[model samples]
Target: MTNPLLYWLWLAERPGCSAKLAHRLLHAFGSPEAIWRADREQLAAADSLSRAKLDALADKDLTYARRIADDCARLHIDIVTADAEQYPRQLLDLSDAPLVLYVRGTLPDFEEQLTISVVGTRRATPYGLRAARYFAGNLAQRGCIIVSGMARGIDGEAHRAALEAGNVTVAVLGCGVDVCYPWQHEQLMQRIIRQGAVISEYPPGTEPAARHFPARNRIITGLSRGTLVVEAPKKSGAMISADLALEQGRDVFAVPGDINRPNSAGCNACIREGGAALVQTPGDILACYAHPRQPGAPRARKPDVRQEEQLHLDSPEVFAAAPRTMRTLEGGEPERTVWQAVHSGRHTVDEIVNETALPASDVLTALTILEVGGYVLRVGEGFCAADDVQLPQQTNEEPNLG
Candidate 1:
């Protein structure tokens, strides 16, 4: 019961301590008391840890661990360990899942026949905003729990739409349940907690760091049945969720963007890669929900192990201090690559990642921005292409991501 406190304490005192290592120690030794009771030889011999790891958990760290456990008992924040039934089965597919989930609200129903993640850039344009609201409204009307980051632009629009539509929604957060990041979304997050829920694995009082977002995206997709991208740039975190969704055997959908606009690139490229489904309306997503979604389905045969282990910039410095770059500002990838090959032309997400070798999460965001900006467009399941020079539409409202 107090292991959460012990683990948090162990982590705070020992910087560079691995969540994976901490999780395993608690699992194997039964409790912090047992772990502290074990001699250096026993802790060092563990397959889960290196000698460096063993040394970091010195006697002083153990005392702090006990204190943390006591604090958890006092606060009553629910601690979900890996073995717990509430650990969220979807995250188990990840190569490195969070060891514990410090949850404040009720966990959404994974057994829901329809669970869809709607994600996009925080600085989305007008088109991105309309698309998010339209898609969220469409899906919510059909009884799907809308999942998203309570970010600005598309994510904010999605939550609002879900609330307006009078349906449940879930906001997967990058910080602790007690702390609200970005400040602007505080009101929306409170609303989300009242209806669907607000969830995070980060411990209480943990600051919302840049590195936490990409990792947060994993849990967003992991908790849902599928993910939909309304907008994103090449380097946006929204794409990270899409990539993870594809790997988890969850369907991915994207709203196309203008080729001239940068924000839609990550989403556009995802469609091109066959890693996601092309969606233009809520029906496109609703169609998948129409057929009974098989929750807890087994994964496909093993693909590239590294393919799934895509990098998400975990450095605190990256999140805390890195200035927004051109790629982040531009946001979209080219869409003409869909027919070229899985990794084919016009700066497709997979190809861009192959060429520039940027992380998948980074590349995916670019595609999203492109889609929302109308730079690229999704055609069908995880497929995207540049707008084939069609006559421009002057429509103000969104067409909906079906």
Candidate 2:
């Protein structure tokens, strides 16, 4: 008989065996130890393993599994199986949960800790980035354990914000726990492991592929009480994460974004379709937790002025700033025309099209140019002239996104 830990590793790494099939075998046999001891006839009787697979399993040696166990010991990686006492309670309830999890750092006590997932598009806009930092920082200060994929843009921003706020954050990877996919984030990954953990279902050498991301996303939401979409396109990995959150009976929250921005389109759509609740501040998300606030929450800091300009959910503030940022476009006829429409209060794309009597594409192109010049700012679903916009006066009070 092989070592118990080796058997578990072997069950997950068996050739041609899918995670689903491995899980079925575990259920049929009672344990990895029992499965390892089962004869070929019994293995075949499970009805899922092919004849060739049965032969391979029956004839295979434990040499490789032994090596892997040794490597993990030397690397300080923890192998958590479904039956392990240290396995996350939240993941066990998931239907498609991984058979085993490879963890490179200390795992938090999910049963006692408040965990939330923050996800978004890799190509996050400046507005989306600010929102991610604001919410994540505030939530971390309140003792929440932030979870994310550690991808670029919003994911990276959220993790950094949490750590910067003197709290912990978990980074669940699409690749191996040892392999950092976005090479540039190697340092950030180390920072995360120190503060929280880096975990994955794949073995230590597996590279991140396109197909691995959706599978990875499931774990992100599975580990949390709720999932937050900071920003995402209509068709993106973040939307897939949101769908998984719904499937798992978890709450979904989306930070509202401008309707005209492609990166924000999915978030707005999620809100409109009633798939997620709109969140303006970290407190809104914190309210969803069933647990009471932990005593001694960290002191809050002043909100960034740039974030306030972009989040104009209240009707009074949406158009409160006078059109003081407006300026004559010296560049092209299209820029001047689009500026005129926005300055004239034809803010929405449809309104601009109607007022300018120009094609939607032309209007959008002109708006982009004007926006780059600091002449326009997005407010809700409309465009606002930035001329009269005043930076909010700094206050000693703690910042709130609303």
Candidate 3:
């Protein structure tokens, strides 16, 4: 019996075949297998296939595709075709969705869970990195699968935080799943594969190129319920992802940043132009998707100033009251140590880890808990104790640093 994936690989790897054209062909022929067996006249009958695409489809050379299948088997990569049950239904909504996806590790059930793409500049600032960590980590703890590119800076921080939160994260790579583009992220890539997945539309052994990323951004946003831009310049790839998310009819959320910063320009523009909703916290994003929309109803779009003001007015107590606080720090030793450090002015995670002499992972976990419980607030790149939250009395003796 012929490998069914061979037909998919052939359709995907055909020279000059764009996703739109492939989709058109799929619509005409119904399946890759049927398209592969179709004659020249049959292929010509398909709409929008130019002479070059038809000739490319006629070449019928499966040698390269066979080699890719071999490479996937040898490297333990899974090739998910568009028709596969495991293929994300979210991507199918796109008119130009990839015909195949190469995956390493388990692909989460994206249809059943909330998946948010966290994207931003590769050269991220301290504020961007911290915001990425805070939002991605907290969202992951809320059972949202974090999706990112696994690039340097913001993307890497998002993936790492999700992993640190002990939740799944999907990295949509421009390069092949078998190849790591930015050699620096080899360790991070490996961790994602072990814990979640690293996926690409490119077949195994395809190297990363500048042109691949714009297409890669579509997959990133397509696989998620929403996209969050932590920070971006006016013309960065993250902005492209946000635009693509909007085009895909997915919710676009951006963390508001300082107006003076160059890296923040895109996010500011997105919010100012009413292209994205301003996200102050993970809760803000969560609230938009809390209830399912009615069939054929519009997705979340540009926020209405009047409705926003009304919302704020309706919840005046939320802003009028003292800083929100939990009754007590109910967590055990790590939480207490981390909270004490933050309350005592150890603002950054590095400072808390150093001052408390706790492992970075423990410090981060504690910080997420404390932030969620309203004992600590994420202020800029660091943290601060929430006002009006009372702490247990301490003795003159130094607290245990263990």
Candidate 4:
């Protein structure tokens, strides 16, 4: 358990040895202990084993192997080798999944559950932040544990909002689970370790680098049922995660943003190219879950306009979904963030949330209503605006997109 595989992974840490080589070794050797016991001729005879790797396989790499063994012993961390019941099934679906996963806390129910990965740019706008919070908060209430990188803007917002809702959130850190990057979110990291979990593939003391984040992004989207991109520039880390999510057979949801806004390009492109679904609110996501938590109780909303808007979007079968708060807006109800977040100027979910201080779930409900009425348009990355016709803020006021 603590020999060749650990050493190879440690050598994998040394720059250019690919995880593919690690996999090949796992396949041929059967186990780390077996690979370590193999003589030099036996090592040389192994097919597809790179010369650089084979040469370093002798006593040279033994010390590092022993040290990692000692480190794991001291930390009491369990290593989930590939194909175990404890291994994350979501990862198995990927073609090049990691050979071993080092987990520090209780793993979530990946086999029976569908985790949603929400990611976005680090330099997020107020709207991006608010949208992340609202989505995380509402998703948590709906019994969905949010997954993010724990970077400053959208990622941090998602984790914090989930925690605030008295739920768990998983942070897939680029560095070691015990380390915190950017320093600003250190306090938040502690909270996550207490309420949820922080995980990484890097050894316990590794620091983060630009290269680590892309691989880290893969884990964030790979381990979940889906991925949501809230806000991103044309060149953003969020887009990379979105790409990986698609490659992993996970659903991709991108919040639309303003075309004129430079920060929204990635999300807008995703929506246009059909790489992602245009997610207007949390309801849209929860509906995808097998057994949604709250299911948005009807009693919480007002009867008139909300109910009528439901009628507008309703299939002929249902007739009227229910008497909810959305029916009151003149042009339509604020049914989803696509419609609700748009005001005199384009607004982000954060602006809406801070001004209204409403939970994102309620905001999602309102946005759905307005979107049905055609009063607003989802321009890009949670940005919404009057759709050529500004509907007056009606008696059915939209909740702020906090």
Candidate 5:
């Protein structure tokens, strides 16, 4: 008996066979097996199979497919065909969806879950990293599956955040699932495989290449209902993902960043050109979906409409004017003191620790909470209070630092 996957693997590995052409053939022939059985006359009847593609499809050599299947079996990897029951239904919506997916872990029911793709530059800033963690972690906590490329900087941070939140997160790779592209993320890849999935269209043993990434970006966005860009330069892969998300009819959300920063240029441009929604918090993303939550699941927080309207265009002055509220100010002891220190012009972490006389660890934790809550923004090596955040009156009683 012929293995059904052999046909898919053969079709997927065929030269000059673009995803569009493969999809067209699938539409015409119904299945990979049927397409395999198609004769020259039948292949000619298909819509857009060029002579070269037809010839490539006609070769039908199973050598590579058999080797890949053997490798996957040995490595415990699963080959998910486009027609498989576990294949992401979201990817099927794309005109150029992959015919075969190499999966290293379990796949979630994508149709029943809210999946968001978080993408940004590999050279991410402190602010961008914090924003990525804040949004990705919160979204995961709220039952949204986090998806990213698992590259360094923002992508790595996003994946880490989701994993730290103890939720499922998917990493779509440019290389094969068996091969970790950035050697640094080998550990992260393993963790994702244990908790979620690391998936790729390329067969096992395929090495990373420059050309594979842009094509990889499509799958990253294709698997999600929305894509969140934390920070990206004018011409970056994150920008490409944002554009692909729009083209795929998925919502694109961008975290607003300083207009002067080159890393922020793409996100700012997306908002300015009305290509993406300006995201201030995870709530802004959840608000867009507004789907019913699972029993006992956290309710999606609605975004502040007035504030969103003011900052819709992502104007620098508007952002500076509409400072985020220090919501956690009244919640804790050291946080209030840390906020007071930053508010009183104590910039760096050391300065805040010295001023508050709190342990560096405590001060750092408080500052992180403050920053992620939008009460403060990291500027260079130091931090500053958000502009226009009304400061509370000084209290005679000191915070309970003990």
Candidate 6:
């Protein structure tokens, strides 16, 4: 008799046997062994597989499948099927969950762990990079396992920060578990394997493909209790992850960014559409896990890092200070004059334009600069001093992107 696990690998590798179709076959036949033993007539009766696929499954040799399993063992990788006890329970909730995960490091008890995915675009701004690090570090210190796509920019920053805090971080890859796509992240991948895990549904030696990424996203969001978008454009893979998380009933958090920055537009849109919560600090994310932790998992009672000075965007003093060398704004006079108008109870664009006596374009430009600079907040129907915006304390000089 063939090894039951080998049958699973063969069935999974069979051409045209999509994840959904494989699942249907499993549900109908009880197990991979049963599915393999069934004749073409029985499979056709299942109605989900095409005749060509059924023939392909019936005729394919297990040589390549066996080679994949052997390669995993040679490289110290583990093949975890959906039916395995080590499989993450969160993934079971996904309708199109992968049948197996090629794991290069230890798999955590996702049911017993607090997991959150941090995702964003490759072209992240300094603001987005900092936000990713701050949130990932604070959450990791508090015992939440950070999950990400292991891509460049935000994802890499989040994983590195989490590991730096001596916490577990899982990287769900778009390629095979053994292959590193970015190549620059080879060293980073090693660090993660030492401290956390690198997992993928694609078998070893599989190259990263365009189609694999969106499918890769479901697993990232699927494994976590929540997904955080640190920065993204109006349309990007990060938003897809956010959408997938929401569909999976996972909490979605978007770090507020400058309104004028294109990198932040997607996050801002998500907030405006009521699709995600505005995340100002790690505390905002921590609050989402209101449910009790896993029975055996210990929650960190003491703060991991010293509480830093908090700054709200709407602080009157902050808005009052006229920066002598501000470059993001057109001129000091326009910004200060506009700030005073809003501070003095002029709310709407028309109202501020009327009161400041400045041209409509100038008011609009200043408002964009002010909001981006974190000096003003867009409340419902009106603008206000950004007094409620909370940001982590300052230590290093702010990056000069200009």
Top-lDDT structure, candidate number: 3
Off by over 4 Å in 3: 301-402
Q: Which 10 successive residues of model 4 have the least lDDT summed?
A: 312-321
User: Which lDDT tens digits does candidate 3 get at residues 1-402?
Assistant: 888889999999998989988898888889988899998899987775778988998888889889989999999999999999999999999999999999999999997889999999876664677788888987888789999998876898899999999999999999998888677678889999999999999987789999999999999999998999999999999999999999999989998877877889999999999889887667677666667778788887544444444333222222234444546567888998888787665777788999999999999999999889877876435676764566666579987999
lDDT, candidate 4, at 90 = 75
lDDT of 4 at 276: 82
The alpha-carbon deviation from the true structure for residue 338 of candidate 4, after best TM-score superposition, in angstroms, is 31
The lDDT, on a scale of 0 to 1, for candidate 4 is 0.68
Q: What are the clashing pairs of model 6? A: 313-386, 314-386, 314-387
TM-score of 4: 0.68
* TM-score of candidate 3 on Cα atoms, chains taken together: 0.76
Quantify all predictions' global Cα lDDT against the true fold.
Answer: 0.66, 0.79, 0.85, 0.68, 0.84, 0.80
Q: Count the backbone clashes (under 3 Å) in each candidate.
A: 63, 5, 0, 33, 0, 3
On residues 14-93, what C-alpha lDDT tens digit does candidate 4 reach at each position?
A: 34456666566657887655666677688778755566666655544556555655676688655666656887877876
Model 4, position 6, has a per-residue lDDT of 67
In Å, residue 193's CA in model 2 sits off its true spot by: 1.3
Better of 3 and 6 by lDDT: 3
| TM-score of candidate 5 versus the correct structure, residues matched by position | 0.74
Residue 215 displacement (Å), model 3:
0.2
lDDT, candidate 1, 18-88, per-residue tens:
65666577668876556656777788776456567666765545665555455556666676766678777
What is the C-alpha lDDT profile of model 6 across 45-64, one tens digit per residue? 88666678978868747898
List all candidate RMSDs to the true structure.
15.0, 12.6, 10.9, 13.0, 11.7, 13.2
The candidate 6 region of ten consecutive residues with least summed lDDT is: 311-320
- The superposed Cα distance between candidate 1 and the true structure at residue 133, in angstroms, equals 0.8
My TM-score estimates for the predictions, one after another, are 0.66, 0.73, 0.76, 0.68, 0.74, 0.74
Q: How would you encode candidate 2's per-residue C-alpha lDDT over 1-402 as one tens digit per residue?
A: 556888888877787776777777878888887888899989999856777789767855788788878877877889988888989989877866788899987898887778889999775654676788788887888788999998877898899999998888999999888788677678889999999999998878789999899999999999998899999999999999999999887778998887777888999999999888887776666655534535464211223445544543232222222334534445577877777677655657888999899999999998888788876766434575554323234479888989
